[model samples]
Structure formats: C-alpha cells, structure tokens
Target chain A: GDSVTQTEGLVTLTKGLPVMLNCTYQTTYSPFLFWYVQHLNEAPKLLLKSSTDNKRTEHQGFYATLHKSSSSFHLQKSSVQLSDSALYFCALSPSNMGYKLTFGTGTSLLVDP
Target chain B: GALVYQYPRRTICKSGTSMRMECQAVGFQATSVAWYRQSPQKTFELIALSTVNSAIKYEQNFTQEKFPISHPNLSFSSMTVLNAYLEDRGLYLCGARRTGVQDTQYFGPGTRLLVL
Candidate 1:
C-alpha cells in the first residue's frame, strides 16, 4: 500500500519569512507526488507536482523537488505572504493505481503579519 | 484548463437518510473521476474511482452499496451516500482527470455533508 506523511501538523510563520513544509512518501514503485493548497472554505488547488527524481518544480512562487532516493518532496517558498496561509496537503498517486490518490494529514500554514 | 463543479455545496441529512451529490467537469474530458472524503479531522480518503464504461472501484472499507457512484458520461458523475450517519459527515470531493492521466486530479468545491 502507498502512503503519504507530513511531519508537521501546523506551521506558523511571520510574513516575509521563508516557508518549508515537509512531505515524505512510501510506495512500492515509481510515484507521482503532489502538493495541494486549500484556503478556508475553498476547494483544494494544486500547488506543485513531480514524478521525476531530483527535479525541482515551481508554481505560484512555491517550489518542490522530488528526491526519490530520500522519498521526499518538501514544499518551499523563499518568502511567505499573509495570503499564503492555508491547509496544505501532500499526496501520492500510487504506482499502477488508476487515478487514485493517497493523502497525508494536512499541515495548516498560518502566516502572521 | 479544466474545471470541476459539484452541486449542493452543502447538505444536511437526517440519520439513515440518503443523499446524492453531483460532479460535473467542464473545459476538458474527464476520463476518470475519483471520489474522496475529507473528514472533519481533515484526512483525504479515497472512497472510489469511477471510469467511463468500467466498473467502479471502491477502496477498502468503502463499498458500492454504501457509496454508489455513477459515471454515465465523460464529464458528469454522481454519488449517493446511503443510510448516512454521523460518521459519514465530511466534505465529499470529486476529482476528475483529463485523458485518464493520474498525475493531476482537478478537485471541485466539495459537497459538505452534515449528518444529524
């Protein structure tokens, strides 16, 4: 079975500071990893995704690099803004599983001004 | 670009009642749709996968009789939660994928279910 793990349950940061949300996963074969952000009362939107190993993908000022050797795809941002606060999820598309996703217990990011 | 829409953004049902939620995909072909439940504790659990012209696949602990899904076309789907209870209360999200590509699943504003 495939699974995703986010080490932090909540991460609070002051505006303009750096942001890092840890994500790790376990799978039997090659996997597709994704980061989804959900604002209060909103649907989850994709932030970034990667399947290739050791390649960094960026979107909306956020970036993540998939490290297959370490089985990690940690989301990072150089500078955080107040609007960046949201519930972030790390998910895995299981190998050979058709369109099914396994998600982690989300990390609530709080950006304080 | 692709977009997913869910009907009845929020619904409240009495215990043991049944409720059905709809999912529609626009701007792209939704070859497959996956249903997930985001519990109050906020864990996204895959309930089932419905593909056009194929049998719906439900995950462990989820059954067709309990969460029956229908994918009659490429762009529309619906799922009925039978005999709803407090434990079934959560945000039910429908994620549709274009061209059966599992890499990206565009999610819709979920149907929030409240069982009482």
Candidate 2:
C-alpha cells in the first residue's frame, strides 16, 4: 500500500514571500514522488518529479528535493506571485505500478498582493 | 506533445441517474488509464485502473457495477457512474500513461459532476 501525506491544508502568503508545502509518503516499494498544481477551473499539471533521494528537481521556478531518508518531498518557491495561487497535490507511486498515483490531501496556496 | 482530453467539462444529474465521461489521449497511445474523483474537502480517491488487455481493477468501496469502464483501444477510454448520489458530486479526472511507462500519469481536464 502506498500513500502520500500533505501536512498543510492551506498556506496564505504575500507576494514575493517564500513558500513551502510539506509532503511525506509511505510505500512498500521504491517510490516515485510528484508535485501537481491545479489552477482554478483547470486540470492539475505535473510540476516536478523525482525518485532520487536528496536530489533537488526544479521546474517553473518551483523546486523540491526528494529525501528518501525522511520520506519527504517538500515543494518550495523562492518568491510567491499572485498567479501562484492554486491547489497543490503531492503524489506517490511504486516503481513497478503503471500510473497508479496515490495522492495526498491537497494544499491550497493563496498568494495575495 | 501528449495530451488527455475529457468530455463534458460539466454535468448535472439527478440522484439515481447515471452519467458517463470519456477520456481521449492524443499524440500517444494510452495503454493504461486511471480514474480518480476529487470531492470537496477531500483528497483525490482512485476509483479504478483500466489497462488494455487486462481486467479493470477497482479500489475499495468502488465496484465495476457502479463505475463501469471500457478501454477498447490504446487512445480512448470511458467510465460511467451509475446511480449518482450526493456523494458522487465531485471532479472526475482521468490519468493515462503509455505502455511501459511506470510512473508517468498524464491527467486530463476533469469532468465536474453535480448531483441534485
């Protein structure tokens, strides 16, 4: 059984502030971690993914490091923007499972002016 | 470029009715498709996993009788929600992956279902 846990329910921040969304996972096998962002009324898009422990993966100004020792892949942004307001989901899947994604309870990030 | 498209971006149905949603993959063959429902205030729950040439696998609390799926080919799949209820109101997403790709689940614009 594989599962993902996102601790933050909602994160509110001002523009230009740094942002972080905590994610942790549990799986029986080697896991692949992913971050998906959903803008209002849009489909969730893949933001970043990594399976290498302690390796930082970056995309679209957002970065996350997969820490297998901690079972965490915390998403971070250097500066928040109004457009960055969205619901972010952390997902996990075992290496052999074909596209079977276990998702966490999403964290809604709201960036205000 | 790969993309997944879901039909009927929004739908309203009365309780006890049924609704069907379609998923189409473009630019690649979708050998496997996974269906998920995102209810308000709740996390995304995987309903089923349908792979070409294999039987569909439904998660706990979900059944093939309630959520029938058809994956006839590599590029298209569909699922029907039978006897909709209040708990069925949510966004239904379809994530697809080409054969041999283990972790790449590309999602489609979900269908928003509102049950009355």
Candidate 3:
C-alpha cells in the first residue's frame, strides 16, 4: 500500500512571502508524486508532478523536486499571491499502479494581504 | 487539451434513493476512468477504477453493489450510487486518463450529492 503525508493542516502567510508545503510519501515500489490545488467550489487542478528522482517539476510558479532518497516532494513558491490560497493535496501513485492515487489529508493555504 | 465533464453539477436525493452520475472525456480518449469521492472536510478517496475492455476494480470499503460503474466506451463512464444515505453525501469526481499518453489524470468539476 502507498501513502502520502501532508504534515501541515493549515498554513497562513502574508502576500509576497515565500511558502513551502511539506509532502512526504511511503511506498515499496517506484513512486510518482503529484501536487493538486483545489480552490473553493472548484475541482482539483494538477499543479506539479514528477516521477524522476531529484528532478524538479514546475508549473504555474509552483515547483517540487522529487527526492526518492528521503521520500519527499515538497511544494514551494517563491512569492505567494493572494490567489494562491487553496487546499493543497499531495498524492502518491506507485509506478506499477499508476491509475490508483493515494491522497493526503490536504493543507489549506491562506494568504493575506 | 484534454477535458473531463461531469453531468449534474449538483443533486439532492432522499435517503434510500439512487442517483447516477456520468463522466465524459473530450479531445482525447479516456482509456481509464477512476471514480473518487471527497467527503465534507476530508480528502478524496478512490472508489473504483474502470478501464476499457477490463473489469472495474473497487477499493476497500466500496463494493460494486453499492457503486456500480459502467465504462462502455473509451470516452464515457457512468456510476450509480445505490441506496444512498446521509453518509454517502459528498462530491463525486471522475478522473479520466489516456493510458498511452502519460500518468497525469485530468479531473472533472464533480457532482455534489446531497442526501436528505
């Protein structure tokens, strides 16, 4: 079985500040990690995903590096925007079972002016 | 660009009733469609995985009798929730993927189910 852990339940920060959302996963097989953002009343959108170890994947100003050694793929943004506030979920999909995604509890990010 | 559309953005049904939701894929072939439920204040849970020409696989705690899924073609899928109750209320999302393309799955807006 595969599992993803997002340690932070809620992260509040001011605009223009750097932000990091912790994400760690556990799996016996090769892992493919993903970061999904879901705004209020909207479907979850893919923000970043990666399968290659140590390779950083970036999309929409968000970046994450898959570190297989530590089983982490923390999402980071250089400058947080007011619109960046949303619920972020870290998911893990074993390479062998790519269609089944195990999601974390999700972290609600609140950005203030 | 690939897109997934879900029918009936929101619905309300009485306890013990049943409702069926549909998932459609556009601009690509959805060889695999996965159904997920996001309970209130909770993360998403995988209910079942439907692949073309293959049997549907239901996850633990979810049975085909309770959630019957049909993937008759590559572009469409439907699932019916039988005997819905208060605990079954949630946002049901369908994630469709083209198996040969990549592992990334695009999700639909989801059908919000409310049980009274």
Candidate 4:
C-alpha cells in the first residue's frame, strides 16, 4: 500500500526564522507528491507538487524538492511569517492510480510574531 | 481555474441516522471525484473514488453499502453516510480532478459533520 509520512506533528517558530517540515513517502510506483496548507477553519489549499525527482517545485514562498532517491519532499521556507501558521499536509498519488491522494497526518505550524 | 463547492457547510445528524453531502465543480469538468474524511486530530482518510462512467472504488475500511456515492455527471457528485455514529463524525471533503489532468486534486471547503 502507498503511504505518506510527515514526521513532525507540530512545529513552532518565531517570525523571520527559517522552517522546514519533513515529508517522506513509500510507493512501488512513481508517485506525484503534493504539499497542502490549511488555515484554521478553512479548506486545504494546494501549495506545491512535483513528480520529477531532484526538481524543486515552489509556490507562494514555499519550496520543496522531490527526491526520488530518498522518497522525500520536505517543505521549506527561508523566513517564516505569522501568517504561515497553519496545518500542512503531505499527500501522495501513485501516478497510475488516477490521482487519488493519500495524506499524512498533518503538521501544525505556529509562527509567532 | 478550478473550484469545488460543497453544500450545507455544516450539519448534525442523530446517531443511527444518515446524511448526504454534495460536491459541485465549477470552471472545469470534474471527471473524477474523491471523498475523504478528516477525523478529529487525525489525517484525511480516503472514503472512496468515483470516476464518471466508471464504478466507485472504496478503500478497505470503507464500503459502498456504508457510504453510498453517486457520480452521475461530470461536475456533480454526492455521498451519503449511512448510520452515522461517533466514529463517523468528521469533516467530509470532496476533491475534483479534470479528465486529462491527473495531477492536481482541487478540494472543496469540506462539510463538517457532527453526530449527536
């Protein structure tokens, strides 16, 4: 079975500090990886995705490199803002599976001003 | 641009009852719709995947008899939770994907279900 794993359940940092959220997956087939961010009481929004290994996909100030060799797509940002506080999810879809998503238990990030 | 809308943003059902949530896709055709449940303090668990003109596929813990799905058209789909109970209470989300594009899954503001 294909699955995604986010090692951090909660991450706290101060504004202007660098932050990184770890994500790794397991799949027998090539998988499309996605990063989603959800604010309080809001729907999860697509942050970034990549299927090409070693390519860094970025959106809105968040960037992640999908490393096929390591099966990792860790999300990173140079400087965190208060608005970055939210729940982040790492999802996987085996390319042949018609884009069905298997999400990891989200990591809740809190950036204080 | 793609947007998915879910009806009845929030609802409460009595234990042993049932409720249905609807998903509508706007802007682009939704060739496939997948339903997910986010349990309290937990991650999103896939309930089922419904592709237009194809049979719905349910995960191991989910059954069509328990969570009936109707994906009659390209843009609209509905899922009903039968015999709602404490374990069934959570946020139900519907993700829509275009026919040719098999990468992005646009999600709707999920329906929050409460069992009383």
- Chain B TM-score by candidate, in order shown: 0.96, 0.97, 0.98, 0.98
Which ranges of candidate 3 are over 4 A from the true structure?
Answer: none
- Cα lDDT of model 1 by residue, B1-116, tens digit: 78899998999999999999999999999999999998898699999999899999999999999999999999999999999999999999999988856578899999999999
Model 2 global lDDT (CA atoms, 0 to 1): 0.92
Error at A26, model 2, angstroms: 1.5
Question: DockQ order of candidates, best first?
Answer: 2, 1, 4, 3
Clashes of each: 0, 0, 0, 0
Interface alpha-carbon RMSD, every candidate: 2.2, 1.5, 1.8, 1.8
Q: Provide the lowest-lDDT 10-residue window in model 2 chain A.
A: A93-102
- Tell me how far the alpha carbon of residue B61 in candidate 4 is from the true structure, in angstroms, after superposition: 1.1
Residue lDDT tens for model 2, B28-109: 9988999999998889999999989999999999999999999999999999999999999999999998766666888899
What is the C-alpha lDDT profile of model 3 across B1-116, one tens digit per residue?
Answer: 88899998999999999999999999999989999998997889999999999989999999999999999999999999999999999999999987586688888999999999
lDDT against the true structure, per candidate, is: 0.92, 0.92, 0.93, 0.92
Clashing pairs in 1: none
The TM-score of candidate 4 is: 0.96
Candidate 2 segments whose C-alpha is farther than 4 A from its true place: A96-98
Model 3 TM-score, 2 decimals? 0.96
Please state the error at residue B54 of candidate 4 in Å. 0.9
The TM-score that candidate 2 achieves is 0.95
